[model samples]
Target: MPRSPGGLETLDPTRQRQFSESGYLVLPGFLPEPLRARLVPEVDHWVDEGLRARSIAACAAPEAGGPPPVLELELAAHGELLTHPPLLRTLTQLMGPSFVFHHLHSDRHAPGIAGKPWHHDCEPNDRGDPALRMIHALHYLGGLDEKVGSLAILPGSHRRSADKTALAHLGTGEVPGETVIDRLPAGSTVLLDSALFHTRRPAPDGPGGPRYFIDASYCQTGARWRPVKPYWRHMLARARELGLSDSRWPELFAERHFTEYTGTV
Candidate 1:
């Protein structure tokens, strides 16, 4: 298939090395203006609706009716944003030829919201090969400055041990090493390995503050697994429309199966 336009076809050798060593890479103006302009209003409307419905505390509280309905609305509304051509192309380049969307979420933090605890995405998983499991794309819809809540991450932390003690420190809100707060302007994107230690600090109270961005995760699909239903049919149709079926259909529709081994006791 013809790759999407707007994303870098090849990372510089320096960047490739940096990504290999640190498990993260920051690209300036990753999302072009046209795409960002299309997505921002949708995000703003969702956040405004959330603010109107309840306070930040209410949304954060578990008993306050599982994540305000707007959260889901925001997610569903931005589904296309998750699949933007440039972003998808870059991800394809990084993760090889095939991958699937794992999850999509939107985080809108108004004034008074508590900062998230620092932690790695790998904490919830027990996979033997965590490195190849997942990666994330965080899209900034508005300016993320120091005053407003911004993502802070520990570069190269993905290689660190996911031990109880380390997890405890992060859970208790201990600042991790060499914090880098992503100060991206509106329309930029940051891609990071899921295993990296990171969190979004709450926005400070004031006028024209920062809000959380839509964060989407993707993972390499395992052999014999279909990440989404009707995967083959959907992609095949898409590939045909794009004139990619003849060239890329096979790789796109490839599948695998494994047999279980059982022995008599």
Candidate 2:
């Protein structure tokens, strides 16, 4: 529960060591109120308007063709969040000054939704360097508690060379040494090494409020990471055109860091 070093303006050595050892960092209330307020309504629109469904369809059958009408970052609040200066600074502290934006996903999980099995989200890099890093910033817009699902992560799991879903058989069942992160204020963000194993456990109660979640990922430079979406070029281009990455972060939205999209690995 070490909160974000307020704006992550200064990455203390202790916090850096904690992230290196634990493979994750919890930044409770990392986002400011205004940004989080804007994000909430946008997430409602994303889900209620069926844009999320259409985006899922596009990814499910890339060969079926055509990109989704909107990418998550194209939404005003989402676009702002993507390059939120404080966030970029925090990321730079962990992955160095150079890194590329990987992808962004926004969703609203309804009450009583089933749990997702334990899995790591790391995608492969053409270089196959374990030292290279891909980090995911998980935004919990409404925060988390028993009413919403809990996130359970195994500390130090990212060091293992296991397949992404190697622990799927265990489902959301408790695992020894796991860290359960169920209590946080609204606008918190948990930064994780994308290879770390984690699971989402459905709320224990029968019914509860929705969970507003959005995740965006980035990769350390020096290797070409796999692209999750077929329209990767368009995504990168739009980010660049929108000036998401400013002078300080030249590589944030660059396309050179990704390999060609290879349909839903």
Candidate 3:
């Protein structure tokens, strides 16, 4: 792997080529153990205290909304994870150094929770340039396996410009050429080009343990990207206030990278 002088893990040219061709990369045990430990408890608090519900309600009814009482990145460990050096380095190698923070979501999915349909999560940009990339870093805090279910992705699907849910007809059913990621050590992370088609498949055995998952996204900075959260400004502001970028990634929290928030319907 070719490493940048910044001392962060760099993707080898081969791996970078694979990501461009496949639209995803799996980094096993990407999150350091200590950080993973802190995040697990914080996730429990986020879900147990009804913050997750409130956050969803705010987004669903942004017109009737107050800001979410606590955004996911507002949590200390999450804030740290947002700027984790190795992850950022990998992202830089993949998306270039000038990328803006898009969003962060934290959740602990119970064993019986239903699978998500085949879909892509690429947000729109004002320039409408398909070449501009948006990537999501999916952190599997407790890892994934047969008991916890799996993630299935269509390789190279991101190359085509398509609607986020163009593959909805498939639901979570298997697709030709799909790659299923079912096993990883604790603290693994999967990086995906946001436009790639993916589906979540629940454990087939009908019961299992909770899955601790956190997903954060970033956009290659050139044109402004659309904001999914109505309170997008506040989210950026909070990230800046907390110095989450560590004075290293100047564009990471810059508001100029986003268009005004048009609530998701």
User: In order, what lDDT does every prediction score?
Assistant: 0.56, 0.92, 0.92
Q: How accurate is candidate 1 locally (lDDT)?
A: 0.56
- Candidate 3 lDDT, 1-265, residue by residue in tens: 3446876587888999999999999999988899999999999999999999999999988889678999999999999999898888889989888999999999999988999999999998889988889999999998998889999999999999889889999999999999999999999999999999999999878769899999999999989999999899899999999888865688999999999877683
Give candidate 1's root-mean-square deviation (CA, Å): 8.2
State the lDDT of candidate 2 residue by residue for 1-265, as single tens digits.
3336463476689988888888999999999899999999999999999999999999898899878999899999999998988888888889899999999999999999999999999999998998998999999999999899799999999998999999999999999999999999999999999999999999988668899999999999999999999988999999888877788988888888989887886
Angstrom error of the Cα, residue 69, model 3: value is 1.0
Model 1 TM: 0.67
Q: Between prediction 2 and prediction 3, which has the larger TM-score?
A: 3
Which of candidates 1 and 3 reaches a greater lDDT?
3
Ranking by TM-score: 3, 2, 1
Which residue pairs show backbone clashes in model 1?
none
